[model samples]
Target: PSLATLNIPTVWFNNPNVSYSKANLGEELLKFEIPRYTEWVRSTEAGSFHCDDTGLICEVKEAVTLTYYFDSWPKLLEEQNTEELHVAGPLLNFKVDAAEAVASICIPHFLCLEGEDSSHVYIAHFVEGEMRLEKPDRVEPHHAVLENPKFSSLGVVFKKWFKQKINTVVLLYHRLHLETPTFHLYLLPNDPSIIKVTRNLHLWYSRLPGSFA
Candidate 1:
């Protein structure tokens, strides 16, 4: 299943003025309006902006209207690597007037399959048409911390090992007709591209005769 399919809840900020919007490509945008830099910093110190749903923590150096965008396993990065690489988190993009900020996000437990080594996970930073893999500053049971000097597109990725058992979901549907009933079963990865394609195909199939009643 894709992140979009999961319908993950959006992050909520302590500041009620924070606004949110969603892009057609399934990107989540969050805008923070801060009146005072000092107060904002104090709130961050108090962990008022940490989002439990998405496990996102952002700390800025200066007070600024921050605009953040998150896309789960974006397709834009599909061609980044010819080799197989599994994504563990969403792509984080942000715009701020500040010079630097630290961002951290929790890798979904399902993506970090049981028995998989945490040390093998890395943060993939996309800059200047290049992707750089870096080790996280801190790794917790469910979170990976990164000190980002410059932020563009950052996500967690890992090389899939042979026989690595990934936790997955299976979908089943039945088509009923006068002649006979047919069942369709699908085994899918937790990838956005595959999910999107599968959804489109399912929609097409639903339009045919003897579809789900």
Candidate 2:
């Protein structure tokens, strides 16, 4: 299907930088077995209406935490030729502070010939899942000709080049509960109903460990 027929925004279809192809699209859908435990995240405070369709209304008895773990890096990094191997954490920890949400990811970087230094902490804060970056942000020099935001994440930067072909939204880690981790994906249009449905249907892997697991 063409973007025009799908009612996709004009910018995605008409822009010279955009292109589409079905080569990357799959004909077969991957299937999953029913999970042993299903844990979901929903906020009635955010106006999520409760329905009795399931004949059970689950409420937060006490604060439950869930942790989501992404599979191992798609590929391993090149071996470091240093005398000592430096270790860094790629594990992401997400927590909500009061009403604000915060995420921290440990990124490994080399420091001169001194071997590996402490991993740098790349922090992204969100008032409501929209990423917050420090001031003095600039677009990459290669893309200066195109329009973009002043403060955008790496995910946002890549979108301009590939958005027409795919839907890429950055979701920050929220927490884990019942052997599953929750994530917060910023929604556009921010419709209350859509937001609730997204939250309700968001999947969690049952085999994964809980928060800090």
Candidate 3:
């Protein structure tokens, strides 16, 4: 699928001193299998995983498979109070037959904001087609800790009333075959929703007459 059709977000690095890393870019999907008698497991990117006493892993007589993947923000969430609630990281989903087995999940993020604090970051849980914001047990610059009672769509969000500068990337698209030689510039946050919107706009503009020089 083309970039315009895909739901994935675009990532760019503007720093001359920094090299690009593919592992850090794009949506990631990972799967793991827990032995029937296993008690704990660790995922390098998703953090440590554990099952509760009443969890499926404890009661079930067979092994279980866990699937973790990054997802895009739902339209319902994007239409809300975006100024007050900003997505700070990739939206993620954890799928397993044993939703009751999940005890806690630690989601990692790539946001680096100025004057960062735990009060502003939260876990956005998409439950029953509704967006529910929950506070994490621990919030740091790199990740947030959450007690996962149930599995659903989850991501990190930042709430702030005041303006603050954050480390971000800028995407510049040059319009070709134009008489005036136009160039479109977008200053976007690290949020996937915003990136997806910007990429769609870019694709639309690229198809216009005289866009290519």
Cα RMSD, model 3? 13.6
Backbone clashes under 3 angstroms, per model:
0, 7, 5
Q: Which residue pairs of candidate 1 clash?
A: none
Instruction: Indicate the residue-level lDDT of 155 in model 2.
Output: 17
Per-residue lDDT tens digits for candidate 3, residues 1-213, read: 011111123432121123211211124422222122212333334233333321111122234456654454644475555557766666655566665444566665445643555687888888876888889887655567776446777888877666544545577777676567666565555444345445544454456676521
TM-score, model 3 to reference = 0.51
Tens-place lDDT digits, model 1, residues 100-210? 443433333235344447677777877766788888876654456776546665666766665444434465667776567776665554433233334444455567787
**Which sections of candidate 2 miss by over 4 Å?**
1-25, 33-105, 108-124, 134-213
Top-scoring candidate (lDDT):
3
Which whole-number lDDT from 0 to 100 does residue 147 have in model 1? 62
Shift in Å, residue 28, candidate 1 = 32
Pairwise TM-score winner, candidates 2 and 3: 3
Better of 1 and 3 by lDDT: 3
Q: Which numbered prediction scores highest in TM-score against the true structure?
A: 3
How much does candidate 2 score in TM-score?
A: 0.18
Candidate 2 vs 3: which has more lDDT: 3
Q: Write one digit per residue (lDDT tens) for candidate 2, span 1-213.
A: 111111221111011112211111024222223222222334433222222221111222233332221111111212323122221112112232222211111121111212222122122322333443222132221111111112111111111111122121232335455455554434221112222222322342223455311
